[model samples]
Target: MAAFDGSTDYDVTLEIPVSIGGLELPNRLYRAPLLEHAGDDDPVDRLLDELEPCAEAGVGLLMQGATPIRGREGRAAPGMTGFEDPDRVASMSRLTDRIDAHGSRIFAQLAHGGLRSMEVWHAGYRRRNPGLRQRVVSKPPLPLRLADRLGILSIDADPLSTDEVYELAADFGRAADRAAAAGYHGVHLAGATMGIFQQFLSPFYNRRDDEFGGALDDRLRFFEVVHEEIRARTDVPLVTKVPAETETPWFVRESIDAEEAIEACRRLAEIGYDAVVPVGSSPFWDHAIIRGEFGSRGFDDRVSRGFEAAFGGPWRRRLVELAARIDAATTPFEAAWNADLCRRVRAVVDVPVLCVGGIRGRSEADRLLGDACSMVGMARPFYAEPRLAARLLAESDATAVCESCNNCVPPQAVGEPGVCRTPAVLKQRGEFEKRGAYEREGGNRRRDSDGPKL
Candidate 1:
C-alpha cells in the first residue's frame, strides 16, 4: 500500500531515519517496553537474550521494560531489576554495550510502581514480606478502599507525604543518572500505566490539596520536577509515555481526556522532553493498554495456581476474571488504536510523537507514519517474533504474527518471561527451529510451509 497519495513507498517511509532529541535513529520502528520477567536469575543475560535479537535485526530504538527506580519495594511484579543494586551500573553497561554493538539505540525506562506495586495487589507477596506497603499519592478512592474492606480487593497502601513526593522524584533522577553512567542512549520515564507519575497526574488517585494536586497544572508539577531533577543529573535525551484516559468508564467523570493529554504533552515538550508517546490507557489496570481477546488460558493458569495470593479469594478472582472478559468484549483489538491520539498530540507539539497500541501490519504502520506519528512501536509482536523488524523493514507487505491473545501478559505477574504462547504460533516457531531458521538467518526467513500464518 502507498504511504501518501500513492507516491511514497511504505517500505521507504518505514526505513527513513529520524532524529529524536538529537539521537538519530536508523529507522522508524521501535520495540516498546514489556516486562522480561528475568526473575532472580542473571537478569542482564536474560534481558540480552530477549532484546539483543531486536537490536540485531535493525530495530531503531528499544525501550527496556520498566525497571524499578528503587529497590525491591518499588517493583510492580517479580523478576524486575532495579537501579539500587550496587552492580546495576556494570550490569546495565553490559546490556547497553550489546545493543549498541548492533547499532541500535537503547533507552532505560525508569519507573516506580506506586499503587500498583505488588504489595498492594499480591496477597501472598505482602504476607510473606511485611513492613513494605505500597506507596500511593493519596488514599485510594473510596470505592477502592471499601472494596478492600469488603475483601473484594487486596490493598495495603502507604500514602506518600509531601516531602516523600519530592524524594521519589529525586529517586527518578538518580535512576536516570545511573542509566546514563551505564551507557544508555537515553531514558524513558514511565509517566503512565498506573506508575507513580500516573498516580500524581491522574485525578482518580491524586486527591492531595498541596501544590502537587488540585488543578491539572498542579498535578503536572510532579512531572516537571522529575524532568528538572533528571536534567540536573544528566544531559541524556528524555522521552515519556503519557496516557490519554480515553477508556475510563462512563461513571468516571474526572480523568485525563484527549485535550488534557495534548496539553500535557505540550507542557512536556516545553519542559524539554525530546519526544512524547501518547497512549490510550486507564488509571486502573485492565486490558485497555493491551486490548485484544482475553487470554483465558493464561488467566486461568495464573489463578488456578493460587487465586487468594493475587486476588482476595476464589470468588474475588472469578469476579475479576469476569470483569476482564466483559472489558475485552467491550474493547476489542483495533489496529493502530493510538493513531488518532498521536495525530492530535503531534498537531500541537514540536517534538517527535511516537505511538504504540495494536499496529500490526506494514500498511497500518505506514498510514500512521505518513501523517499521524513520527515513529511506530509494538510490544507483544516482539514477543511473537523477536526479529520482527528485519521482515518489517524488508517487505512492504509484512505483518506481525502476534495474535493479540494476551497470553504473554498474565504470566508476567507470576514471574514468567513474556513470550508468545499461542499454540499455532509456537508450532510455527518450533518448525522453524527444527529447520535451523533462526540460526541460519536470524529467524527472518519465512517458508510457505511454515504452519499457520497471520
Candidate 2:
C-alpha cells in the first residue's frame, strides 16, 4: 500500500477506477452489505426496489446483503432470499439486470449464520419449531449454556463433523454457482459478523482437534476449501469480510486479535480472494461493529415487540438490554474506525483491501481511498439515504445526514425493512406521518416525499 503524502487531489483519487479479479469498477465508492429484509412476497422486486437506487446514484460496487445459501435452516433472520432455491435465483436476474443498466456491479453475498442463527437467538421461534437446531463448529459456549439452563435462551445445536464441514463448504460453492447463473458480477462471502466462517476461524468458537482446527493454518482450512469450491463452480471475483476481534469481553482470552486477523487476510489473498474488507468487530453481537448510541424508541420497540422472541422472558430481555447499554457505553462510534486495520491488512496482501465502519463523509472516504484502502464503503448510511452515492460521488464536500443513532437496526430482527426511523431525518425528507416515522410498514417503498435528492 502506498502512503498518501497529502498532495493528491481528493476528487481524482476517489474517481480512479479500480479492478478486482479482472472486474473493473467505475470508482472507489462501494455500498457495503446490509441485510435488506426483502419479504417472501415478490422478494426479487423488493430487493430491486431497495438496491437499484444505489446503482442509479452511481455507486461503483453494491454488495447485496447476506443471502442464505441454504433454505430456512441457515437463515439468520426472517425475510432473506434463499439463493439455494433455483426459482428464486432465476427471479434475481431482474435485480442484476437493473443494477448493470446503471453501470454498477452487484455481488451476491452468501452466508450462513452459525450459532448466531435464529435457532439459537429467538427463544419463542425455537419453542414453536422443536426440530430446528443451530449448527455449530463446536459445542455451545458457557454463556449460551447458562442462558439455556436459566430459560433465558432456548438453544439446541449439533457440532458439524469433519465430513459435514466439507458438505457445508460445497453448499457455498453451489450458492456461488447460483449467483453466477443469476448474472451477478461477483460473489462476496460473509465471513465476518460471527457467521459460520468466523465460527471456524475464531478460537472462541472453534474447539476442535481435527484437521479444521487447532493451529491458525488448520483453522483457516474451511475458508480455503470454500474458496476452492467456489473456484471450481464459478469464475467470478471473490471478496470476503474478515473480522479483527479487536474488542471482546474482558473474560474472552481466546478471540482473534488484530495480528491474527491481518495474517488471515494475507492467507485469504494467497488463497485467491480478490479483495478483503477487514473490520473491527467483537466475538459477541454488540456495538463494536455498528457503533453508535442506541435510540430509546428503537431499543424499547426491539425489546417489547421486535426481538421478544429473541430475548425471551421479561428478566432475560432486561438482562440483554442492560448488556447492550453497557456495550454502547464501552464502544462508542469513531469515524474511519477500521481505517488502521485495513491499512495493516493492505500492507501484506497484494489484493485490494476495502475499508468500512462509521465512515460518513467525502473527506473520510477520500483520505481512505488516497492511502488506506482500494475502496471505501458505507452501510447504515445507505439505509438512511438509498440514493446517497449521487452526492458522495459527485460533490467535493458532501456528508450524509444519518446521525448513526442505530434507530433503524432493531426492526430488521422482526422482518422489517431497513429504513430511517430518526424523526428529524424522516421529517426533513417529508416522510414523517401521523402514524409515526418508526411505525412498521407493509413494504419498503419510498413515500411521495422521498427522492434521490435527499
- Residue-level lDDT of model 2, residues 160-228, one tens digit each, is 999999999999999899889989999999999988888899999899989999988899999999999
Model 1 RMSD, rounded to 1 decimal: 5.9
TM-score of each: 0.91, 0.91
C-alpha lDDT of residue 434 in model 2: 44
Per-model CA lDDT versus the true structure: 0.81, 0.81
Which regions of candidate 2 are displaced past 4 Å? 1-12, 300-303, 429-454
Cα lDDT of model 1 overall?
0.81
Q: How many residue pairs clash per model? A: 0, 0
Q: Report the lDDT tens digits of candidate 1 across residue range 9-45.
A: 3333666777788887777889999888765456888
